[model samples]
Target: MHGANIVLNGCSDRGRLDQRAAELRSAHGVECLGLFANLTEPGEVDECYRQIFARFKRLDVLVNNAGILQDALLGMIPTDMVDRTFRINTFAAIYNLQQASRLMTRNRSGAIVNITSIIGTNGNQGQAVYAASKAALIGLTLSSAKELASRNIRVNAVAPGFIDTDMTRNLPEGKFQERMNSIGMGRIGQPDDIANAILFLASDLSAYITGQVLGVDGGMLI
Candidate 1:
């Protein structure tokens, strides 16, 4: 959709990926390649990048959107929950960015977007570890931006508020209204809202923007 050949990386859902790839080809004539890899595995990450380069030969944009949320309060939080959250959300993102930056630096031009959460910006109850892991990405975004800028790679983050997704829908009914009240818009955010912000950061429209966390929360903090 953005005039760049897209390679979507996912850990599973091959059937869905194939369907979307066919849809993109049929609707927009876009060549979309979907690859599945366990992003938490360093070896898998490396192989995924190897496949990407073999096919695309170059990398331009990276959207680090893979994450998992397991909500639990401080004392009751399971150790394994923390490990899974950090592995999927923080570590895997670093692995992907590390690989993507290497390829982009060769061309001296690229954009990277990390999808964080509004809860990361303003911590919420029962999400201590989840928030912490996401906060790490903000630090990663800023630091990576400085390190990669000289190489002509831009790094940014998008913090989404309460969005209508299966993940959020699973939250307790009380949480739903609690989030709505927090947002000045008084409405739940749509996935497209986050996509638009990422697109801006990934495109030339934000050529001069980097090392920044854009909140796509419908004024949730305000």
Candidate 2:
């Protein structure tokens, strides 16, 4: 893998952010810039992109990984919660892709990887809002990939299934076991599993690929 300099944008914890950046620098010998911003706001997202271009003068890859979950049954979900979930998970990616595509188009090349979810592909009972938001992202990925293909910009998505992250860890033990039972792999996926797939789509390995959604589910969708 290329040891590329990266911008850790929108990270709020300065202490932890700096600590991790130092670790990356020391371990991987890569430059890391930690910029704090609110992605749900278009202005803030724009500002973050502006800083990236101002410093690096170019953008080779864009990964839309910021998302929030507001799970509830469709009938009981509040209107505000639905709006907020879409605003952050769907609209925010659109805003960033618009800006990133602009920069990537200028260079005539770039890769964009959106972090979607398998729930987007197969609807979940209590995750109607979250699934809808992620589904929107998949649509964006396809449309953007087609629109930007002429400019040599590739747009794709990674749909992870119940990865073991801070969010998934919050599930009760019984519910977690049920989730594991649902997966054919019979084990929870780690964050690195998703990260590796993102890296593949972001790299030349998938240079010929676009408008595709790679499911990183542990055979859950199979």
Candidate 3:
């Protein structure tokens, strides 16, 4: 069971985003604080940091898991959709990393796990914008790892493929099934599968791992 004091940012008002995280913390006897910060807005992100710092005085790990998808073929993709996706998926993570890493540097030890996607590594047909944004995050993960390693901070990413969450459930059944069958495992992944990997990267077990992208995709890429 995990017994770490954790903060969940970029959570939604209805608490859906952090429901599983909170449950996991309770089951594991860990202290979990949920912050409903809209990562797309800088002001909200800063306020969320203020609250977390005010309560905990320090942060040990940061998981940038907030993201959005606007799926359309490149020609059909709206300019505004592309802009919004980049704003939330890419810019938000960068801003949070900047602020959170500053705190981690003071302490000289921390782990930052970013949630990317397989689409990022192998571009998908209708997800050009989303994939591009996630690809940028992977790049950021590597560069930040180099920049922060000297401070004893580790930066890494997890790229999940066809995870079964509300986001995927909302997709058309035929599309979802087609995607799942494409994977060698012949099934979609559960959120816990990805969450467990996140827990590992956040814990000391992965202390030696950094600047790496761990794919939790059931051999989809292979």
Candidate 4:
């Protein structure tokens, strides 16, 4: 195992999740710096990156994994809900990429993995805004990859389906089960499933791959 030191930004909120992550890091002997930042705010992002640069002096990987979903049909969705979803899910990724790419271009080597969703590729009812935000991320991934490829920066995305996370746990059990049955694997995915794909994208194993959307959905996208 490479004792790769990492700064995990955006882990400060949500009931002190950073505390638990820090505990795990201590147990594993990994240097994990957790910072608090509201990703939707540019000023917070800037400050977070400044802290990272001040400490690490270099950034090798950026995982744009912070996202929110407001599920409502387009006609029924409130303007505020749509705007908030885009601000956090889509725009935040772009803003992070803007800063991350600048640092990466200087190093001429970095990897960016955006967390997307299968709903982005295959539209779903009552998830218009969420889907749209993720779809925008896919586009951003491709465009950023093309622009950063010459600099040796790889930009890619992972589209997850029916993942068993706190977000999905809030769904009605019956509805969640129904969705799981549609997956070819006959089960929901885990966060590690997406995380593993992210690890690969960040590792040298995927050195030649870029501008790709690796679907971690059990054949759901097909």
In terms of TM-score, the best-performing candidate is 1
Residue 3's lDDT within candidate 3 is: 61
> What TM-score quantifies how close candidate 2 is to the native fold?
0.95
Comparing 3 and 4 on TM-score, the stronger one: 4
Candidates' C-alpha lDDT:
0.90, 0.90, 0.87, 0.87
Cα displacement (Å) at residue 135, model 4? 0.1
lDDT of each residue in 165-208, candidate 4, tens digit only: 88889989898777877899887898889889999999899999
Off by over 4 Å in 2: none
Instruction: Please give the distance, in angstroms, between residue 178's alpha carbon in candidate 2 and its true position after superposition.
Output: 1.2
RMSD list, candidates in order: 1.3, 1.4, 2.5, 1.8
Which runs in model 3 stand beyond 4 Å of their true positions? 10-30
- Higher-ranked by TM-score: 2 or 4: 2
- What count of clashes does model 4 give? 0
Q: Sort by lDDT, best first.
A: 2, 1, 4, 3
- After TM-score superposition, the amount by which residue 124's alpha carbon in candidate 4 deviates from its true location, in angstroms, is 0.3
Q: Clashing residue pairs in candidate 3, if any?
A: none
State candidate 4's TM-score: 0.94
lDDT by residue for model 3 (1-222), tens: 246676776454646647866786878777777777777788888888888788888888999888898789978988899899999899999989988998888789999999999999999888899999999999999999999999989999999998988899998989877787788987789999999999999889999999999999987752
Arrange candidates by TM-score, descending. 1, 2, 4, 3
- The local distance difference test score of model 4 is 0.87
